[model samples]
Target: MENQKKVFIIYHSGYGHTKVQAEAVLSGANSVDGVDAELIDAKEAAGNLDRIDQADAIIFGSPTYMGTISAEFKSFMDASSSKWMEQSWKNKIAGGFTNSSSQSGDKTGTLQALSVFAAQHGMIWVGLDLPPGNNSSQGSEENLNRMGASLGAMAQSLADQGPEITPPDADQKTAHYYGARVAQAALRWAA
Candidate 1:
């Protein structure tokens, strides 16, 4: 009987790269029918389990540093121990994203960390519907340059693009498409 799907994106951005991508992902998720999306700094999300408890689906994101989830995000994960113990997130939908300065910036490590946490919470995971390979420029647009974003919903932005630039149109579209897919899945399962 729920009328809407809520997606909570929890992310840690060390130098703003992941923050930008997280926003793009939110924009995408918000575009989906009957979906509401919001982004929370890792610290806040970790501290306020009530907000997290309200979400129908959760997306984790962070910049890959030393090939792993940033300490900020990891701290949030660690803080979720209470929810894990309570089985507060069991059966919820989960997804992840990351960014790095190198083309292969140990991004997968971040996703691995997230996946492990979700599994521990007994959550269901969602995969990127489109493959990174052979896209005919349906291409994730993340492929244009060489930065480390291959894991999860990875993306690249000029580290120095300043605040003037926004998530590129293609990337935003991809995010929206990803959002719609996940939203539909969340709705289906919730029903």
Candidate 2:
């Protein structure tokens, strides 16, 4: 497994939906034969900086609130200042996913924020590679990337619903695909 790639998923979920999405991403990354993915909640990542520094790729996830990443996620990004200063994460693959209550809930803003944070850390950004799904008459709602996000996975969950009832299967599948894609990219980068 010398060629194996290690990916760390760092995220914060206010109501658990984002955690589910993170799990899907982890599952997808684990599907790759030489990829090992681990989930670290943003709230708890302070103790895991070593893992982050050792990772070949990092995938960030967050719930969109007020048109951007949740406060907890923002805090995590802010705390990475030391890494930024030292360029510890430089050139590592970076990707992200975000969830919101509405289809157009400015999820892009969150994605943009994540991308910018990654860029500032000198990480290479990875975009979702899947074509837009559920965009045509023949497309099914079950299709992946139905939200048409190019930068990362965008997921919609009902405001009143719990994680178990929202972010639908399609969104989770999109996240899974995104994780797999990032891991693959990380593997290639390592090679």
Candidate 3:
């Protein structure tokens, strides 16, 4: 539709685990009726910055490495300095997602970095609205928002497992829900 809002998911996945999460986020965003969602590999984003500029919302995804975003994704952030200088992304809806092998692999630090990156671009940050899950005595890894992240979606995968077998259904579902929320927010913000 002409009025459809665009959402770009820019991510860097080293071993495909984070790519799975990004795909889940894409699925959720595309599920919204008036949204057009697409994935942009962070490695290739520097050449497609204009496409990103046209987006109504942008969701960033990366694997948490050494307690923060991977160097490659950081490169994409640096490449956007031109946009930051021009405030081209100001007021655009923004959200983030990250994955790590350990459950508490300091993923919050990565989300904080993403948020800060968005802030530097003068973008509006959108956080996970779901209540913390798997925090109760009866809670299990099967709960959505299992990592209890509020800044963004978080997923954990076993170091030895592949994306097809790890990160679990709950994390994917949480990423999906987060994607939809961002899309909905974009629609409302544009309206």
Candidate 4:
């Protein structure tokens, strides 16, 4: 695994649902033979630009709150100002994921914010490449990309349900695919 690429999943999960999605992303990244992935909570990631700098790619995840990224994840983004000033993340690969109670839930705003954030750092953004799932009678709940997310993985979780039940298998699979896609992009960038 010499010269192996590292993918960091930096996120903030309020009710543990987003954590489940983060884990899926990690699993997908690790599935790539030489790619290493780790999940780091936003609280723990604060002021930790070194890890971000060293990683080949960084995938951001945050529970959508008020139609945008959660404040906790926003704090992490704010803390990276130094890195921004230094342009340390410039040209690095970046992607994002978000979860909410409703299917739409303004999830696009969160993803858009992530894209802008990545762009501010001069990072190349990677998007989910899958088509919409659960769109027709032929589409199964088990299919991936049910949300038709293109900017990144988007998940819906019932406010009353636990992570075990929501975000469904489909959303998790979408996250998995998104993660693998990012890893592949990182590999290409590294090469």
Best by TM-score: 3
Candidates sorted by TM-score, best first: 3, 4, 2, 1
Backbone-clash count (model 4): 0
Query: Which pairs, if any, clash in model 2?
Result: none
Q: What would the TM-scores of all predictions be?
A: 0.85, 0.96, 0.99, 0.97
Q: Write the per-residue lDDT of candidate 2 for residues 50-93, one digit (tens) a residue.
A: 66898999999999999999999988887888788899999999
lDDT of 3 by residue, 22-137 (tens): 99999999999999999999978877887788999999999999999999999999999999998999999999999999989999999999999999999999999999999999
Q: Cα lDDT of all candidates, in order? A: 0.75, 0.91, 0.96, 0.92
Q: Output the better candidate (1/3) by lDDT.
A: 3
Better of 1 and 2 by lDDT: 2
- Looking at model 3, residue 137 earns an lDDT score of 100
Worst 10 residues of 3 by lDDT: 43-52
* lDDT score at residue 41, model 3, on the 0-100 scale: 98
Every model: Cα RMSD to truth? 3.2, 1.0, 0.6, 1.0
- The TM-score of candidate 4 is 0.97
Task: Please provide, for model 1 over 1-191, each residue's C-alpha lDDT reduced to its tens digit, 9 standing for 90 to 100.
Answer: 25898889899987776787787778878877788889899999988997799888998888888998888888999899999999999999988877666656667777888888899999998867665642464544454222323335665455556433644554545555565666677878886
Q: Count steric clashes of candidate 1.
A: 4
Q: Write the per-residue lDDT of candidate 4 for residues 1-191, one digit (tens) a residue.
A: 89999999999999899999999999998888789999999988886778778889999999999999999999999999899999999988999999999989999999999999999999999999898888998997688988878999998898999988887888888888899999999999988
Where model 2 places Cα greater than 4 Å from the true spot, the runs are none
